[model samples]
Target chain A: MKKTHYSELWCSSPRFWGGLTFLAFIILLGLGATYYMEHQGHWVTGMSNQVVWGLPHVFAIFMIVAASGALNVASIGSVFGGPMYKPLGRFSALLAIGLLAGGLMVLVLDLGRPDRLVVAMTTFNLKSIFTWNILLYTGFFVIVGLYIWTMIDRKVNKYYQVTGYLAFFWRLVLTTGTGSIFGFLVAREAYDAAILAPMFIIMSFSFGLAFFIITLISAYWWAGRTLGELRLAKLKHLLGVFVGAVLYFSMVYHLTNLYITQHHGVERFILLDGGVYSLMFWLGHVLIGSIIPLFLIYSPAFASSRFAIGAASVLVLMGGFLQLYVIVIGGQAFPMNMFPGKEVVTSEFLDGVVASYIPTTAEGLLGIAGIAVAMTMVAVGSRMLKVLPENLEDPKDLEHA
Target chain B: MSNKDDRPDMKRREFIGKTVLAAGAASVAPGVLLTVAKAGGESRGVSSDVRYGLLIDTNKCADDCTACVDACNRENGIDLVERPKGQSDDDWNAQRPQWIRKVQLKDKQTGEITNLPMMCQHCEFPPCVDVCPTGASFKRADGIVMVDRHTCIGCRYCMMACPYKARSFIHQNVAQQLVNAPRGKGCVESCNLCVHRIDAGDMTTACQEACEKDGHQAIVFGDLKDPDSKLAKLLKTKSSRQIRADLELNTGVRYTNV
Candidate 1:
């Protein structure tokens, strides 16, 4: 085993520093955006009647799914039980917590009345998917944070293990709950299916695997260390399996929607001819998110190299972005009743039926800032706390540290 | 086992008595409502005028009366210029709304058209009330569906849950809204059955008043429960239908065949 200085491994590399700086700048931008919104109401944002929820909502959902996926290392350790994932388990935990915090920040700022956010918990609408989502997210955040804190502490109590189990159980439930929000909306022609919840599960699994792979690669490269062939092979194979599952689910979600006449109206319209939203849903989410990433991860020759894994991870993340974007934006693109040009379709007094909303430059900038904030938090936390295990390759090497 | 059967019988009789009381209240309630109004009107030295609700004969809707919309905006202190369109979560009338919309639907095959005014159905069993987490969206004693903005969290779940899409989310503060019905962001809003007017013993809505003034009493105003009221008489003689009856919402607003 190659011995390295503990201090050097824990310190931030130049790339890490640069990434941190960029991330901080973006967070500052997001803060500025939030301030502007609070002072001036939602008029500051480009959101109007048609596209009420835009990039912030999309990014929030994406980050939430990504953060859930980021916890896989710990999940594997507790449930799947493997020493291979142990090295990066703490890092994953930290990333998961940090990313969720960042996601919540985006969502909180997106609200028209940020002051009334706590009312979400107090006034729980049992039938509302959104109300359930708030509860699930809050529960998931608390449990995940406690689990991570316990893992770092040397003399943890038995309750910590219980806490870890609670986290795992609730995380699974939360993903299903997120899925059910869209799944239960029978009135919405676009998203009425039993498969949506399972689809979200598969998506969460795919995103989680992709997140772990990318983070693992980053830690290895930045720490001037490398993974064993066995571990890398296992990860690659697991990613391949997840990518295939995601592909199958994605195909089934749309194909099923297309098969039914009632669903065909809005589903086909959005998928085939519903204009820009259709293009993004079909090309960005399905083609790039599912097909390309599946091929990259599953191809044995491609999956073996670090470069290939990195490429696959990037593809999966991109796909995840489009996946959420399509679900949120495409869900709204179709006229509510699937009948267009009617008086209801075009507010007779107003210009159009659907109020048009495009994310402004400020909205886009704030989204980017949210991303930077998440990455910076992860980088900073890792450096200060020595989150990644220093001598995972060999215990004898730990003596040197 | 025999005692168990007798126990259910005792419970059933009590339930029947309670239901009979409720039904009797439901039947005699409209007359009582008018009598109480007459008493109040007498005390206030105002005319004991007939209380009216728009019957909205779909057949005579002209399938296009921007007149009602214009008058409602002018009378109810609604913003006429900035109209919300499409599937939006955040609408301008997120709170403090006055003008109600009437959507014209065209049959895909026969080319036959009908105007469906998209207003709060003032349902006897409003799902908005059943599903409101905070009891903010409620049905008044007289049967108008209204929301208490002060307690509303503005989550817009009621908007999503409402099958008819009658509820609107207040996205911004409407400082210029009539002081009687001032509203801020984070509330779901809808037609209050012109409750402000109704409370003041004014039977007709701003839209109905305007429509009547235009010599187009395409809108008939009366109590549904009153046998002699125009709305009740129309229901007994004519084949009137409520929108989306399949939902089993039992909406108060009914329209005759076009």
Candidate 2:
């Protein structure tokens, strides 16, 4: 029987303090960088004519996609009403809100005028993909936050059930917006396919499941103090399905490109020929990201343990970064025109065309700082609030936070 | 012809009377009367003649001679500081304006390299104007795509939306300017088609003038709608091309065949 004692246990975790300090340090660094950029200009970052987007953009987009995926637990529980996965509803909702907040901080810093972010909202452009993405993300965050609050409230509000369904649908739409930002460039032959939006949705599952599993494991080990055997078994099975889907989606994403030779020129050259992007895509995404994690998640013996699931999640996260690295940086690495002959001629002569990009030391450091801030928030939130329930209640009581 | 000739004189007197009568309407349209007054007493000047445009013959364009670039800088008070040959947007100051940029192209079939001057395409339905949230970027009725610097919040969405890579943000304060134009920091800027010169009834851009001075009518400016205008006649006489035609951007600037 769980004791009714009201003494707050969450605020006492050592991980909570450590995470908070790390996040604070990162926030301070980001503030310093913002001040420099505002005074100095874009030159403070490594973006130029050729490499228009640099490290912060790639990292921010990865986090945004990852954050959307991270909310899958809430989506599966609230919408699907899957009896087996109902236990993680509140945790998933909290994570979805936290990670999105962190991801937004990274994006806000990357803009030319961070202060003008309000202007982006006040003045709306119906046609711009970025504008649409902003609206989708804001709506997604609000609905998810409200859904979680209603689920956790003492009264067991029925309204959350409706919002839960809405959150699930909106996430699918949000991922599509992310994909279309790149895919809708009709003039850019590299990204003119219908597969990209679906690809983003699939990749999010991989990222979301991995992140969710890792967070659950961390909470069990250091925060909640216990995760029962039955819940563990169920999470492993759910992860297995997602892991399999991720593998299938990746194969289809690449194999389809190969099937259509006309569309595969520059993208194929980079993926197959070991260009700067190819090395990362093959090693980071395919090998480390997909294969090893898929094997670990499938293995019956290891899948049961928190350690194995956490390790596999680390690999999956690495792969997500590499995947984004390839899609964004690799996409830009080649000139817009896929005509090999024209590319050869232009690279030889034009000033900005053949220009290669690597994130500067400052950019890399600052981007890392952004990730640290999210980690800090999660740690602090878990410490200061009951982010994790202290004891596993019966599956019937799982509906309550 | 009689109707056209007689209306201008009658309207010239009537225009003054109408201006007095429409004083309240004139206040509502802050800059409308100024433009009407500037049109200078023609009931309708040749629509073809009054609305000027530019036609560039790519074949005759020189690889280098920035005479047009320098003249435009001098005429409009553009600042030129030495930027490193290649610096990324992240590393550059945020307020540098590159209104006119040079693009170097090489023939794929024949290994001949050439420089092409690139600026805002000034599209009939400009994507930049379509995508601007605050209406900072607008295409004037006279066919100039311009940014109102005061209203621009420096979001750089238009910069991302542009396919030609024509727009550049002002990355730094350029204190030493050539022509005493009101240049500011922290804004996206591109070629404004020399509105100051055009509004004063100038026939062409500084670049076009510089091209004419070199004895090659390489860059010709006139109205595309006017059948007898050089730009219209060139399009009619020759099969002209536009860069990145696959985007279907419907660019106002047309290139005579190379």
Candidate 3:
């Protein structure tokens, strides 16, 4: 018998309605941007032949990776038998589906031919990792949906562990497929490294947990429900460990590249002097995204502070977004080395030069819209389903109240 | 009894059998042993026996000459494409589709400069074809790599995978287009080695013709599989090499004296 009693969200605060309305406005703006950009063609955007994918990709990719990570909390409780995480299982599963939906929405809308999405579903090249990803992503929804059912319905509750295990493994493969999409690109010097697969998995853990904490805190606060401090602390610790692992993997990835003489130019371009890219990598990703978050979670001064935890989560998301921007856009900026020992003096195709990319207003709006869609789904779903628990207050605090 | 067994009738039977066997062998051998001849455009489908390719002599190609590039654009209807509104010349130039372009390379060791016209290498094992989600980017029976725009979802994964940076994504609304070369927005495309001309039995390519007309004769287009063709003979005699040969793509296009 479960000790926790799950209940539908009943917060009738006017602020809640206002927040939902704001998200809807953002979503509409995003759709408008997509429509205008598509109508004018890709020429209206910063993406060119040189820089194929832009800011939209950065958001979509991060959200998709994070979606897989969000399910980890549920998996820990059901599959790994963690008592503290049992109450979070339903919401975790819900978020996994919600984030994926939002991510896929952005990705599809940004396609050169969004109408031809039917073609993507109908025709497939098995050799392509992208095709595999489509299956993985769709399977994630079905499996996670079923997993949620087992958690919700008493009749199917016995099958929770089976679905939990399946969801856990599927999410692993799904994130791998996403990472391999870049890793399989042999032409790009920044990619083709096998470490990217595992790196993305760790990235999912960090970004997903951060987003999860933000959602948990905000939802509880909005509902005027007390969230236990002990659980938040545990989540903060988990996020710190994930962030540290991501840093370690990033270090290994860069060090391995530096060892290879052919990859030296790309390394220097990304880490040292590649202006915007270098700043994003060292400052945005490393300092603000990784190191600062670690400090907030670990230091005695701020570790226990709820405000600090929220700030850290938001920073992790910011860092993850920029890191992906570097991987997708910065990786393409460096010129491909076609001639082994020859220098391209001049070429009409901009060979041997860095490709420039500046995000348009439309792209920024579309990216943010995807995030709003994700949060909106979670909010609506919380109301519809008994996903969130009534109150996660410490028993002693409840007695005092 | 032995003498009777070796009679004239028995000897005649053996001789007749040998004669019939010899006659059958002589008549059926040609039909059974010979392979089918290499077919041209007259065939229902592009023949696998014929692999079209180009050979470029970099020594003869001059740095100032854009004849091949210009000719390819004009022949493929790429010259008719105009820059869209609100796009700068620099951005448009980078975004616009260029089937072929002039590439100038300087040797790292020696102060030697080499000029060449670069386009689709048309590798036998093209990475673009391997990565395409819809199998839109594919190779023909005659080893010509091209895109099927209808099936293409405009993902541009093929562009990222092409080591030669040959593929281009159509970015603007195509106001005008030639019947032979159908281009549109939201899809990727690249040099098809003048497949329209090939399908019409025109064996020569625009680039090869232009290079020859300029008296440089830098490009030679022919059937690489044909042992007697000039391309095959030149390849046999000269030290022609595929760019990035270390990848072992076995590209249809080869360059000499790079």
Candidate 4:
């Protein structure tokens, strides 16, 4: 393997300024949406008493999960000793940090009392999964930031391997904490399963790698760098495996619920008659997120086509977003099972009926802006830092891959 | 034969004595509750020695009665809340603060119907307390689970954790809040067992008082620790059960004859 050299992104180009300006515009729009929601109270959005969490959570959670997953390239190269992947480590860590910052911003801004974030930070209910996440989420920034330093600094490059190991372990636990937020909800039938922890971990891998693939291709192409065809092939195949793993976990989750007689109501709701929820699970999550991506990446017809890889990655993100929507919003729409055998004849709180949620334009804008925040971070960071490799056109032997 | 005839008279006399004694205790419960806490009052604060509770006879809960609900709203100043401008009636109805609301239920197998006013159960080991990230949802020493408005960031995780759906978020800007309730926008709240009244050394809650005023007398409020208290005595007489008893929450509120 040849010595890998990294360089800063060119900043004077018209495309760079245009892209950065577009991201800034999106971020401004998102902030405006947030201000409107906060001023009007959560009532302005589709969120209600029944559905407390809305589209913002779906966006925030997906970005956080993908953030952890984005670090996989760094983990593989540094901790697992994949020489071919070493050059990608710097940008991988940067992207991970950027995604997390953007995601956290959305999570905090969407709070009913975002100004009281200080209370959340200062006060601690050590038993609650959310408090644990606060510590884990912040801790992740420090750990990953340090790991990026090890990769970028010439004097500390020797310690990159050790830092990689720590980052790898922290991200696993961080995603676990995220999953347990839903997992520990014993009151709701849709959550409260231990399987959620591993499912989230697998989700991070699939979503993260897909995001990384798209970002890498776009970045390299913009810089006029020599991105090797073999490297793209390897990433696509790995993405396929991750997508397959996600599918397996999702199946097991549904199958486990099917065995319980009590969980039948919730299962029937999500799988059969949950309207938009059922449709998204089948068409978006299963077909688009997993199956189609697998075919596009592994198919012989699209072996040399970059568009196939890009399309597959985009589909995975869209499908993953829909999957999260089903998990967060769909889970809340189902009424609480207060009575096992008896039916709630009538109640003021909309008991015994499925909740309806039609997300407003403000909510949709805020969610998409979360992605823009991540992109802007990466764009700015790359301009000032030497995270991108100068060339990757070296098509190595298949054995190294 | 003479002894048997005398025993019947003795039994009748004893039954009347106990009934009168129980009735007397029920009437003076307010005085007992006040005296028990008066030694130190608010200065000494609530003690674990006294566990506040309520016992409701669902069979006696009138189908058309909104007395208890109306009383709670008046007491907590929930009545002052108005729907914000441009808000739909449907949305406002759903989002309005409800410390307590009437609930109707029907048994699937038996076709038996029951009407009850549902509110916070005030569980001994409340799920809301466990899930709150900021320790804002806390249980008092006397087993009253409530949200501390000062610290609550209004994340609404408590609402999700509560099985009863007892909690509500203030979606619109609040105005004309009573000093007792201290309500505001973007905060989670519920029936705090009329904690303000309890702290002020009041013996009865608004709902319990209204239930009695309207001649239903379906609700009883007293110290569960005092065996002589009306609530405890009634609990012993009736086969009362907690909602979702399988969860073993050991709720402070119990119902009978549902």
Better of 1 and 2 by DockQ: 2
Query: Which CAPRI category fits model 1?
Result: incorrect
Q: How many clashes show up per model?
A: 11, 21, 0, 0
**lDDT tens digits by residue: candidate 4, A261-311:** 989999999989999999999998999888899999999999999999999
Residues B1-118, model 2: lDDT tens digits: 1465857777777878787879967686766776777577445333333444577786787766666666666666664544533664434432245566555566677866655566
Q: Compute the TM-score of each model's chain A versus the native chain A and list the values.
A: 0.87, 0.88, 0.97, 0.98
Candidate 3 structure quality by residue, lDDT tens digits, B1-258:
135675877778778988899899888876555423323333578889989999999999987999999998999889888789779987897799988988999999996899998899999999999899889999999999999988888888898898888988888888888988899888899999999999999989999999999999999999999999999999999999999888788999999988
Better of 2 and 4 by DockQ: 4
Compared to the true structure, candidate 4 yields what TM-score?
Answer: 0.92
True contacts kept of 2: 0.25
* Candidate 3: RMSD to truth: 14.1
By the TM-score metric, which is better: model 1 or model 3?
Answer: 3
* Candidate 4: segments with Cα more than 4 A from true spot: A395-398, B1-43
Instruction: Tell me the lDDT of model 4 at A64.
Output: 98
For residue B33, what is the lDDT in candidate 3? 57
What is the per-residue lDDT of model 1 for residues A1-401, given as tens digits with 9 covering 90 to 100? 44322222453457777767777877898888877765655655665433446788778777777777777767777766655665566777777877777777787777656677666558765765666778788888788877867767657745556776787788778778777766765445666578988888778777877877787677667766645655666676777677778778878888887787767767767777767777877787777777777777677677567677778778887877887877776775555652332323224323223334567666776677777767777777777775666544543443332
Q: B148 in model 3: Cα distance from truth in Å?
A: 0.4
What's the lDDT for residue A287 in model 1? Answer: 77
- The lDDT of each candidate is 0.67, 0.68, 0.91, 0.89
Which model is ahead, 2 or 3, in terms of DockQ?
3
